[model samples]
Target: MRAPGDLRADARRNRELIIQTARTVFAEQGPSATMDEIARHAQVGAGTLYRHFPDRDALFHAVLTDALERMIALAETTRKQEGLAWDALSRFVEGCAGLRLDLLISVAGSQATQVATTPEIGEGRARLLKILDQIVSAAHDEGTLRHDVGAGDVMGAVSLLIRGLPTLPTDLSAELKNRALRLVLAGMRTDPAPIPPPVPAMTANDLIRRLSTTGPAKPAT
Candidate 1:
């Protein structure tokens, strides 16, 4: 496989610049940020940007793939920690709540989000789910997580929280985000009688479908 170090000096620089510039532009302009704008911000020509990322969906795929890889690493680290299983799970979940929240919010809130679900995105999501399942199984074994709720339930609940994030006031978003997350965890506790008929986790396909449908379209100029 071609490694980062294998890239020629200019090619590597251009690739890195495009991703860096796109991150900032996408955050500020949402998923509607254009390739020309990203290319300009990166001090590269439109041709250069296209050479690195052929299209908008491809750019999003690269950005989200990296974000998902980071999250997977975080989850692996948290899972290895020695503590109450719930605590470990909570740490991973919290990290996930903030990890790429901005990027995903923009993608999910965009009108063209359906096209953003590239194969790379799907693979990243699947890997994440596998890691989550490992942690969830441990939590259940330790009597921390409710026996009835599976990893899918956790995934589904988090999805609900993420979908609502854009609607909240900017100032209160973080607070409400934390509150919503805590509530999702609280419901997974073994203390009270667990709710029956566990909520299914959102599959990679389901997540893409849901996100693609969020928010109204930007009005035509």
Candidate 2:
């Protein structure tokens, strides 16, 4: 057997290779592609693949969660920029969306957002949600979006972004992503005038707390 340190190093290397191959395969085939193809392309043995992900869905979940976390990081970084609420959020979302096609495709049919129940997924989710909520509530508070739209509704919007995942070209440009986000954002707008000021950083807990004091924080992006 290998020493623990050696095993850890090997696992990390395998994970990086898997994530890289998954990004490529997912872009080409979406989430339903066979594991054999992934293993073949990555040039790793099936046993090694299984060692990292016990099943197809487990692999898909890992890929998906990793993607959303990247977006969350973008959101946190973008929120500090000074500008109109819509532009800041739009640029961040569009920027992340541009980079997300592969990850989104990997988990497309599975709908397995693995972020909430999985370990280490929270730091990313909380930060991502906080940024998203900040922009969303900011829009409502600033009269950019409708006031009646709830955070659940915003979550539904997030799901729509995923559902539309397969359709979006993996290599989209600044203008195209903007067009797509605009269409989606427009759907959630309402007639109520703005009254509430934008809230602080968004979080899964805070977003869920708004939904119900008792419900689970939404698990996926």
Candidate 3:
């Protein structure tokens, strides 16, 4: 028989494969996709998939976690680039917004309370928010974005746009999204720094929990 530790490692690797495969499926097909499809895509045995992710929502949450990681990475990179605050912040949001599904999850969870708050999701979102706050702050100080738009407010607004990442209406979805981000930035600009929104009570973590629970309902094949 295989050593217990070795067996555990192999199991973890397979579990990761399931998560990776499911993420691709969710991105391509949506959150409601069946486990059967996910298994096929991941090339894992059906039993293996179930062993790793017993519930549909668990698998869905994994996909969202992956997406959040990507968003945080995007924010981290942009914060390093030297540019006009408005320009960098605009680009960052647009780039980050490309991860549409995750953003939508947060928005839905925050407003709808469809998903209860979860710890894992809350941690992932905090990193993304921190990055956004940094970018917005730089822009605000440089007077690139609206001086009135508080960095916190900008982060929240950008999160919404990303959450609603929609299929591009025209042939150029990307171009349109960037343009929209710019408009949002322009609207936020003040001579000093952007102001924040009124207290709504729900934090980004609350929204992430909602997202983790609900996921993107992968549509039927």
Best by TM-score: 1
lDDT of each: 0.71, 0.61, 0.63
**Which consecutive 10 residues in model 2 have the weakest lDDT in total?**
191-200
Candidate 2 Cα outliers beyond 4 Å, as residue runs: 1-13, 101-127, 149-151, 165-178, 185-221
192-215 in candidate 2: lDDT tens per residue? 222222235446775455446433
- lDDT, candidate 1, 1-221, per-residue tens: 23557989989888878887776677656777789988888999998888778777778877766667877898888878847667777787777776644565566544446545767678888998898898888888988888898878887776666555544344344555666676677778886334232235436786455446643334311
Off by over 4 Å in 1: 1-5, 9-14, 20-24, 41-47, 108-119, 192-221
Per-model C-alpha RMSD? 9.1, 13.0, 10.9
Tell how far residue 28 is off in model 1, in angstroms: 4.6
Q: In candidate 3, which residue ranges exceed 4 Å CA deviation?
A: 1-17, 27-31, 100-116, 163-178, 189-221
Query: How does each model score on TM-score?
Result: 0.70, 0.58, 0.63
lDDT for position 24 in model 3: 55
- Model 3: per-residue lDDT, tens digit, 1-221? 23224558778788778867765565555555679988998888899887767777666666666677777777777777746666667667667666555523532333223322467678888888877777777876776666567757766776666545344322233444555565565577664234233235446786566556655644434
Candidate 3, run of 10 with poorest lDDT: 107-116
